[model samples]
Target: MVNCKNCGTNITSKFCPDCGQPAALKRIDAHYITHEIEHVLHFERGIFYTIKELITAPGQNVKNYISDNRSRLVKPIIFIIVTSLLYSLVAHFFHTEEKYIKSVDARTIENQFVITSKIFQWLQNHYGYANIIMGLFIAFWAKLFFRKYNYNFFEILILLCFIMGMSMLMYGFFAIIEGMTHTNLLMYATALNFLY
Candidate 1:
């Protein structure tokens, strides 16, 4: 028997009994890289599966994830980050500019609220993190309103993450349509997102 590299446990089989680390670790190579990618994007139990579940039956899927089976769904935090990043990339690719902010004198804005402007710019650039911050605020309000429910604040945040992630996907899909058609559909997208 070999010692487990991860936890120094004696291994008698393919994995470590104590730590579950593989008996033999694969060297980093092209095959390893390909396998890792497949592991993450695999259709059966990866992001695609999670997206399908979220889209088809959001309420029941989330309920199952929170209560019964966590493995079937992608982790809530990762789901939000991946979806938000996807939306950001698609928006950038489509050259979609922020609609509200138009032709403000940088000097005056910076001089008035340097920190606030910086924070806003950062949030605009990094949507994944920005969405998480937004989710925290949303989760707080949801928790307050649904105090009768048994779920805690963190659980509510998980629900928000799944929901916000799906919303980001919706936005990304709309961004694609807008880019292809070369027509401004921001209002329609926003309305549909709210309805969703």
Candidate 2:
């Protein structure tokens, strides 16, 4: 038996029972690189699986994630950030501008609060971070309304992350359609997102 390098625990199997480190770390070769890539993009329990579960049975999947088994679903925060980044990339590729924002005098807004304007601009550019901030507000209200339930604030936030991540994918799909058709479908997409 060899001692686990991670936690110095003696192991008799392929994985350490204490820290779950592999008995023998694989050398950094072509096979190792390919395996690492597959591990990250694994369809079984990775992002694709999470998306499929969320689309099929979101409520039950999230409940299981919070209560029964955590490994089946992707971590909530990573799921949201990945999906949000995907949406942002698709939107950028489609050259989709925020048509909802009307032209305002930049000088007037910048003069009032330069920091506030800068913050807004940053949020506009970074969809992942902006979505997390929005999820916090959503989670707050959800927790307040569902105070009778056993789920805590963080659990509710996790739910929101899964939900918002799916919504971002929906937005990305719509953006592709809009780009192909050369038609403004933002309103429809927003309405569908609200319905979701």
Candidate 3:
């Protein structure tokens, strides 16, 4: 006899005595229900609005948001969400060459590193591409200039996230220009950076 999945009582009926849950689970539907659609719409609206505000307003938005008495600006988590979206768009647009030409007498992971660096360089060129570089500067500035802030390094990181998040709006604008021009600024930036 087939045993009841729920309550583990002997199979007499479909449901078990302990609880009224189904003994046999129903198969999942191919299409999601309206409830799922509502949930997705709700989530997407929040993200879209947040990205719009964050990208458009930057510092003013952050100041009026995290400090002032308003609740409409995008949350901090949205920064990561939009960043991931930008990364996804970049990944889709930038396809690496899979074919590797064998060197005369040496085999190294140089090709893979080059490809990875290219992607990072591309991202940096577009999104304030100098974000990490500027971040280091900001980090140093916070250490020395803001010595009276009385905050630790970790606290500075939190502040930097906001500062950089705001600065990244500029990066996004440049990304649009680069995308339209069909030119990768990263190539030039990489050359200059390497030369230094």
- Top candidate, metric TM-score: 1
Ranking by TM-score: 1, 2, 3
> Model 2: residues >4 Å from true position, as ranges?
28-33, 100-105, 108-110
- The lDDT per prediction is 0.85, 0.85, 0.50
Give one digit per residue, the lDDT tens place, for model 1 in 1-196.
Answer: 8999999989999999998999998899999999987877788879899999988899999999889998898889988999988988888898774642233335886577666677777876888898899999999999999999999999999999999999889988888898889888888888877877
Tens-digit per-residue lDDT, 1-196, candidate 3: 5566656666667776667766777666645465544443354445456556655665565556645634564444445435544643543354211111112222265465666556654653444334444555676778888788666654454445555554344334444555667565544533432432
User: Backbone clash tally for model 1?
Assistant: 0
Model 1 clash pairs?
none
Question: Which residue pairs collide, candidate 3?
Answer: 124-129, 128-171
The regions of model 1 sitting more than 4 angstroms off are 100-105, 108-110
In model 1, which range of ten residues has the least summed lDDT?
97-106
Candidate 3, position 42, lDDT: 53
Question: What's the lDDT of the predicted structure labeled candidate 1?
Answer: 0.85
Please provide TM-scores, in order, for all candidate models, with all chains considered together: 0.89, 0.85, 0.40
